[model samples]
Target: MSNLAILPILLPFLAGVLVAFFHKNLIASRIFSIIATVIHLALTIFIFMSVQESGTYVLEVGGWEAPFGIVIVADPLSALLTMTTAVVATAAVIYAPKSLSRIQEEFYFYSFFFLLIAGVNGAFLTGDLFNLFVFFEVLLMASYGLIVLGNGKAQLRESLKYILINLFSSMLFVTTISFLYSVIGTVNMAQAAERVGEVEQQGVLTVIGILLFFVFATKAAVFPLYYWLPSSYTVPNAVVSALFGALLTKVGVYSILRTFTLIFNYEVDLTHTLFIYLAMFTMIFGVIGALSTNNVKLIIAYNVIPAVGFMLMGIGIFTETSIAGSIYYLVHDMIIKAVLFLLIGAVTYAAGTSDLKKMGGLIHHYPVLGWMFFLSTLVLAGIPPFSGFIGKLLLLQGGLNQEEILIVIVALISSLGILFSMIRIFIGGFWGEADIMDLPKQKPSLAAMTWPVGILLSLSILLGVGAEMFYPAVSSIAEYVMDPELYIESVLKE
Candidate 1:
């Protein structure tokens, strides 16, 4: 069954290639994309279940040995993330047909979409550090194509900034990987994890670790490095925006979680401490941006930073419980963010604008959109009875256990700010007088788009209400990540 690890990557890569050929036939393209996503989701679920029941599966390429050949390892963490990516990407595909323009649909949008999934899955599952870099490039190139799908001027300008930053980040990643290989003598993650502890110049190793982290932090949009996200995220159409918002940044977070725990495990005192402070500041600055934004898209985009901060908090605390909370929180944020973006997209469609000041009293007319938006805000704010609350609760508990008083306070305060910003959106966009001037004369049929939103919203509810069932799995994943000895043993064995 270890071969199943490669299926997630191969399925999407092949499907995407096939979808590219159907670009001229929009109907065929749509059907193919939807079917492809559904099949991908099913396969991902099977892989997740198989991993849980059995153990981590590592597939060595070309019959080569460990630390010498490319490998894809499907551990619990990677499997869960891949599953979440599939779900979110599937939703985006379902929503894209109606949300995206005809030209955009016909111009290989589905191809790039599946390719992005392939890259993401490959990134999640690959055991080789250089292969990880390779996967990042694959996903990023796909993103570059996806972001400019419509060929709009705003999309081009913002995508340019987005591309430039990612390009720099990629260069840094390669440099760090090169430096790491020079220091550790291998580009295999498990090998590096074992070899890093034996290196003589621990100081140099630590510096390289920090540098690599900074590269990922830029991608994850930690404070001071996050200025490009909001503007670039908002320029794309809602489907593309939602996809970017949900999956792309999480890849960075996933990398951080993987590397900090796996390869750079020796310098906990220095590296993890840096994460704590960075997480705190990231939370503060991110929510401030969220509260200050008037554009609905930008508001949501800004919040992604703070959410990243919250996950970083768990990592900083660096306990099994804390790591568990962070994993749960990461998954929760991915789902809820997708829900929020799609909900906001629906409102944008109805109003023909994302400006909060120019829109009002949407609930009186489009009550479905209003209520869904309101509930999703609560989820985003970590209100009770939602998945967000469970994640927040666990993270808070983890922080308290670690005696991180300042971050706990910062997180609590940031939660309030998040609530305030989201409430502001609710009040400004969904309440008060119905402003028909800004709204579309012919309200678009939200029937198709709403299905995906509703599915995600329900899933968010399930994650919260069924937290007990999930706690064991999340706890197991955390344990595995924090202690990668078994992981390394499995990957290196014949």
Candidate 2:
């Protein structure tokens, strides 16, 4: 059992609570939040390195043991995601002080922000499915307050929709857990996987698998279930958007990735095949929404959906290269999406409107911002020499190797659509008639906004150009997914 494993979750919670006491002191609150996030990132990096050395670290809370008690498993997959969460959270926390209104700041914004990070970290580490549900609520409850911080009408309406959908999904999540526990007599994920493999009634487990997919799909906001995401995310300020865009939905994607690869692999022919097709349609529809939008925020929001499908396309393919590709894409997307939202936040801040038609000549005023958004567009669309390209190439190769021609063709076409939709913003916002509107009265200092965006975008470029450096880690993560025995043995045997 490792004490270090718990710190990613616990340290943030403690920092958040301490920040709450600084409600009357903004300087202290911001300083503490930034420090805590930086520390969390450093710790997760250290934990990730240790996990790389030993394969996995299983920590049983309160000296409890195995399936009988709470467990936190920091395998390569979870460790990688936890590290990414910390990095993204650090960016959001750094970006917040300049972006958030004084009223929003005076309230418990920093506390809520760190709480959200803690919840995300806990979700990544928890070995128990029930504890996973608890972490979900923790993050969602914190998000509800963050969403309504500006107290705007649009924020209230959209956040209510966001909350109700999550509540429904949470209820469904609990019911699924209860049913699974009744069947296996355990909610510990590693134990459940072991029991699931031994159970003869593959039919009921398939139903459970499908039900679990439905629940996570709702949160990941794939296709038909994705309507709430664009609207809800669009209402929040850029920092909140960056955080949610970078981390939240990835948790749902992570859960789906974890469960299917671990607990529900017995009926892959049925379950995975269904997931593959849904992922295909999700990409198609998501790109369509991006093309249909004039609002840059909605366009960015819709773009989030298509990438979700792409990441899962790798998972649904369930091959080594495919899974590795998805993991890379997941980490890459987190950084790039944060970069995108931060850029758009800068975009809307300078333009005074999210409507692309009302924006023009941005390239003249902010040449670096325009070029960054333009390159990010290329990255998002999987262009060569960019991060998205490597993952998309692997995914396409996997699909073709599996002779999933329809998915391959759909993925290629969707990339083109994604490219056009993003370029629409560049062309409309940066290249056209210089039809700029009055900038926002409360615009932030350019350096404050661009620093986070530039750093994240540099990381995205490094991710692509330096893909070889990440090859071993992503490959091992793929192995863990392909062989749950590695995960189960590490947890129970330890």
Give TM per candidate.
0.98, 0.98
List candidate 1 stretches off by more than 4 Å.
199-201, 435-441
Q: In candidate 1, which residue pairs clash?
A: 361-431
- The candidate 1 region of ten consecutive residues with least summed lDDT is 435-444
List, residue by residue over 16-101, the lDDT tens digit for candidate 1: 99988868998888888889899999999999998999999989988898889999999999999999999998888889988888
Q: Model 2 over residues 339-400: C-alpha lDDT tens digits?
A: 89988998888787899888888887778888999989988898888899999988898888
What is the lDDT, from 0 to 100, of the residue 100 in candidate 2?
Answer: 85
Question: Local error of candidate 1 at 281, Å?
Answer: 0.8
**For candidate 1, what's the RMSD?**
1.2
Every candidate's CA RMSD: 1.2, 1.5
